[model samples]
Target: MARLKTLGSRIKESAGSRVKVVSPGSWRSGMTSSQRGYGYKWQQARERYLRDNPLCVYCERNGRTTAARIVDHIVAHRGDMALFWDETNWQSLCKPCHDSVKQAEEAAGLGG
Candidate 1:
């Protein structure tokens, strides 16, 4: 009887001999909240806001009921610490609504 190789083992064997080509000025990078200098304070604030507003504000407004997974600022902070920390300016949103609709609206408002 033959045993099946695990996916990780197969990937490891194939990756060992591959030569990856990365461009010197490639645009394949992104920053996380912590990488952008948002530390434990930001995380705690987010959690608290989400806890208070467990449902997606956008979805609720549109007559849908969805659980929120992100705490979003009503106005873009644009490096303004005061606005960023304003609890009244926060709203809860699901990942899809935040990523698709809210982001698009923000981008459009920026004339992009």
Candidate 2:
């Protein structure tokens, strides 16, 4: 007979594995987004940036006027607080462009 697997056993398997699994937009440190610097200050900055740059840059390039909903780093910050907070390195992007095109560029090493 096959043995039944409980939730605890499944979690134990993940804990015992050498490779770690992380969800999108989450750090490997397992800290909350606020702890990782997406706290109140970052939220305020993001709101101000989006207000100043209300259209997606990529969409604007294509003659589309999509509303910007995300502020992305032109270069990957990689835990560098200076780069992370640099207003000059920020660009406004629609959710679709940020999630798809920007993510692809970062994955392909073109974002930096």
Best by lDDT: 2
* Model 2 worst lDDT window (10 residues): 7-16
TM-score for candidate 1, please give it. Answer: 0.66
| TM per prediction | 0.66, 0.75
Q: Model 1: runs farther than 4 Å from truth?
A: 1-32, 35-37, 110-112
**Which consecutive 10 residues in model 1 have the weakest lDDT in total?**
20-29
Q: In candidate 1, what are the lDDT values of residues 20-54, reduced to their tens digit?
A: 44334533225456644367988888888888889
Q: Which lDDT values do the candidates have, in the order given?
A: 0.78, 0.88
**Model 2 agreement with the true structure over 87-106: per-residue lDDT tens digits:** 99999999999999999998
Q: What is the lDDT of residue 105 in candidate 2?
A: 94
lDDT for position 8 in model 1: 53
Alpha-carbon deviation at 79 in model 2, angstroms = 0.8
